[model samples]
Target chain A: MTSSKDTEHPLFQRIEGVRQRTGRVRDPIVTQAHGGGGKAMRDLIDDVICGALGMSAQQIQEDQARFSLAALAQYGDRLAFTTDAYVVSPLFFPGGDIGKLAVNGTINDLAVSGAIPLYLSCSLIIEEGLPMETLRAVLQSMGEAARAASVHFVTGDTKVVPRGAADQLFVTTTGIGVIPQGLEIAAHQLQPNDAILINGYLGDHGAAILVARGELQLETTIESDCAALHGLIAALHDAGITIRAMRDITRGGLSAVLNELAQASQVHIAVDGTKLPIRPEVQGFCEILGFDPIHLANEGKLALAVPSEQIEQALKVMHAHPLGQQAAHIATCRPTPAGLVTLDTGFGGERILEMLVGEQLPRIC
Target chain B: MRFVSEFRDPATGKKVLQQIEQQLRQLGHDASHPLKIMEVCGGHTHTIFKFGLEGMLPPSIELVHGPGCPVCVLPVGRLDDAIAIASQPDVIFTTFGDTLRVPGSQKSLLQCKAEGADIRTVYSPTDALSLARQHPQKKVVFFGIGFETTAPATALTLLQAREEAVSNFSVFCNHITIIPTLEAILADPSLRIDGFLGPGHVTMVIGLEPYTFVCDVHKKPFVISGFEPLDVLQSLVMLLEQFRQGRCFVENQYKRLVQPQGNRVAQQAMQTVFEAREHFEWRGLGSIPHSGLRLREAFSAFDAEKHFAIPAQQVADPKACQCGDVLKGAIKPWQCKVFGTACTPETPIGACMVSSEGACAAYYNYGRLSTSRKLEATR
Candidate 1:
């Protein structure tokens, strides 16, 4: 039996070597031939995907990775799954690119749910004539982000369309995570008197992307706050703090997230404008463009609702982490006047923070 | 943020609030009949709501949002004319972002854009000129809309286009003078505004001499104010002091920015490029003589009205909308029947409900909840 097993292993090893030797792509630009179902496609995949992601020979050969039943049972029966598509114009920005955004975005979605992100499936749609260097840079960014977050990309697919049929490139990431037992966190779980905390300043990502677009023609030093947050979340749990709900402040920003929580939990959220963390530069950018910072987008920052009793411990844990060095207590949930978010202005007035109707556009006058 | 932070200091704001209260007390004003001060600039209205200045004021003082939002006062007929020009196949229509959402009789620029119209939002007319330069094959028309503050920028851009010989670039000039609009407001008997908080930016262009009419003819106090929380509060104090002393005169509280003679070069550029229209119909207030500006005969080649054949037909305001009353400070925004029910930022029924600086949009988005809470607390 030992002799038979050794012979089978050598046979598999020999097949992988032959495949690797033959499947080496040389073209510097993506073309229709790279996506066609032939040797060219295999060569492109082996050179671009496996080389950049550093996939093992055995892992690259499998259609999908399989896990043992015993390993899956340790994290409980619930699995968290989420998918997101990244299509930022300009493809690259001050601090991150589309590939990094795809990885961090999906991981954040799962992380905010109190789950441990484990695996991700990447899919790329490449336009013909895209330079290989750009692809390599993007793939390298994705690989580094995945490694930093400690998640594995076990499977992926690639398709090449005609030039102008798509943008230079687009990436979609689907992530799966495991939720531990006895842990429940959801938007609807927010209770009255819960403390609302933010991990850091808002609008950095939005301001950075806006400047990177080159429309404003103004210089800025702001960088996108795109990052994974599962490690900071784990630290919070380790601190023995009970987290009721958490949400990453993205597209519509802090105002949107607060409104969502208010509507889901049927409570009122009163945010103090002075207490909300905002960088001076971001504030200046919004001032010139006539935008409200609360409505601006964020990437790495998150809003958390913890029981009043555990807020102190949660804040301590958050402030100790690198990502949460600027953590702040922004607001508090109230039992009365359900489904509303109000801001106590720094200038001493109260106003309702509503979800914006459409995109916030710069005012000329 | 240096110049900005000092004007927004909460301590200074409180001190100004106390002075306003003291002046009101000297004038024997109370909540029963609050002293209504109309700030005739959308920028001031925006600052008031953004900083919660209204709530910080004494109940004896009331702020009346005025018809200073250029987007809010654009007649629907003019918007339709703009849309008609924008829908042409070879035309690339450009406008400020806030103006894109203002509804015409048939459709808004946003809706037209979604249906494949080439409407782009530009920060300034210069940006539109750049687009024109890039797309020489397409006819570029800029919807130039603003008061005197923005008119100078549009004028300068047009002058540059002429110098560069960019034949494809033209402007649909809807620039209105503030003096005429303010005069129209004062002439109205329904509006009980005791004093006026003049627009700082506009006065920086037109100068203080033009606003002296408010004091000379109407015997009403007018204070040129800056667009900051402290500026607004301090301006209110100035206006109240005038009321307390029974004086009606023009004061310059924004002296740091606005010169007595205004910006000479900007004024010169405007004169070189534009001439007053015979009459221009305001959205809420009816036609005022020589209120709007049009390209001069020398610059007719760059006039959108003359370049394109547009249907310049008159369309009446929605009957359900009381924006005229709102603009004239005759009624508060919430007092309008369809404020939150039908006219909202999402589905705006009036121009005032569309722009961010519009009184209705500001009240709807920021003031409604707070006002209700204040009522609840009082109860």
Candidate 2:
């Protein structure tokens, strides 16, 4: 017993050290010193992502002692897996950051999959020689988000690289959660008579990111709705309604996601632009931006599909939840010719929602 | 919404369409004397495409997209200037995202960004102020690009920058006034354009007086139209009526939004901040006198030109590209040798193909898709 335990302790420390060094040197913007694999890599991790995030000593430890399977035992069966990368130009923004975005994004991926998020595996690739205090702040924010979502960080991998190989810092989080018993949801499972519903307005996240990065010049204040949606999903499931399909409106916003679903299910999605609740400030912003709100990204929102008959029930339950209070029935399922997301314009014309050909704006494209 | 929605009523739009149709029939469908009319603004082009106005118009009333969309017309040399400024160690370049994809002397702003340049896309002029305040040590140059509609905001920003005395902030002004460009197109004998669809916002600022050139010198009809879908249709109807009556004058279809004299305070601010450059380069039409603005000498400190020594360089247009003919309304987009072949939207070789407001882009987005149905229709 003494021989095995003692051998494993040092082995764990060595593995942890390797993981830390790797995260620093493999950063998108790498530097010569990061490749040196000496003090530079440690400094990179300590300064950029980990330092700003301010993780506890336990979290910083490079071992599996901090994790437990019981933490994710809430949902007994089917597991949901999702991962996302955060590469916003500006490291910080109004109302949130990469840390918060990483946490919320992982949780939403599971939530919209009809799963109760259980645990997350965080991976960070940070640039070399960034400030220590900035890294600490980011870590603290990530820890707060994890705690708020009631999810545990069970495992993680870190990599670092030389300067100029990456942006300031990028965090990739892969989440695994368990789907509740008896819950069956699939994109192709959507029936022709299914109704389309949205939690709230679109384009807030994309617009906020634009404003935060100082890319757009407009006379409006907009903020990203970067939030975890586990609470809202729980409320919806408890309302005793069967869901056909669900998805979070992310990168391509509502339109891209809707187009994907419509193509998958071989049915039509007709969105009512007028009924879709849009913030006046966001709308005013879109007018000058030449950006449609529907094609913008929404972080703290979800679109759900349910039978037309169950729409009233689903809407009532969504209304009861704070996150879903602004939820609206945006469209109905129509027998469209196999595949298309048609938008019924305010002027009584129908426009096809074409798949995004290129990045909406090329700076990020 | 209040000022924009009322003009798009279907019932009224139908009436205007009917009136134009009747007038066009009276003019007779003569190919040699086609009633060619050019909507001389990018905003109009966008409206024309969005509403499928070309398909709705009479056969004789040929609607040509004019030299509008400043982003589309911004030459590669100026883009290179912006790229040079953006690549500077202590300079942050702010521009619209549309400008980033535009090629500049073998490089684009997006490509520069990929090379670690501090290029940011902004939606409004004020956003540059924040970047300036945040990066005090770095020079923040707002690559000001747009037509007169956007000039007021850019002017206000320069005014604000001067008042604040933000040493690190400057504007690389590319704002081209619309009047001379219109004049250049109208004076050209080859165009033979019957009437002009005047710009609404430019009219809002400089007022209807500036467009008197069409009536006085060019002797062509000018109808100032709002940007809405129905407003464009109404303007066409008005132009056709003027043609039927053998009248050459300026009419206003966007009376609610535009006035004879625009916002005086805004114009006064622009006058204080900027002055007309003796001559400015247009992408397709070459150099036009008094078409562009430079910051007044008094506001030189806030002008990027005062700090940087980048020389303005003239670049030759790509050979066989017919952007000049297109801008002059002498040829349609389809007539260009590279219109949809070597110069498709994915690989745009000219400004007209790049900008969303560009005539080529409008044609590609709205009309090109249905080309097979109208293969033999367009001249």
- Top-lDDT structure, candidate number: 1
| Model 1 chain B: lowest-lDDT 10 consecutive positions | B369-378
DockQ of each: 0.69, 0.14
* lDDT tens readout by residue for model 1, A193-258: 999999999999999999999978889899999999999999998787888989999999999999
**Backbone clashes (count) for model 2:** 44
Which stretch of 10 consecutive residues in model 1 chain A shows the poorest summed lDDT?
A: A1-10
lDDT of each: 0.89, 0.77
Off by over 4 Å in 1: A1-22, A56-65, B373-379
A159-232: candidate 2 lDDT, tens digit per residue: 65567777878889988889887898778867787898888877888888877765443435787899999898
iRMS (Å) per candidate: 1.2, 5.7
TM-scores of the candidates are 0.95, 0.75
**Against the true structure, what is every candidate's RMSD?**
4.0, 7.2
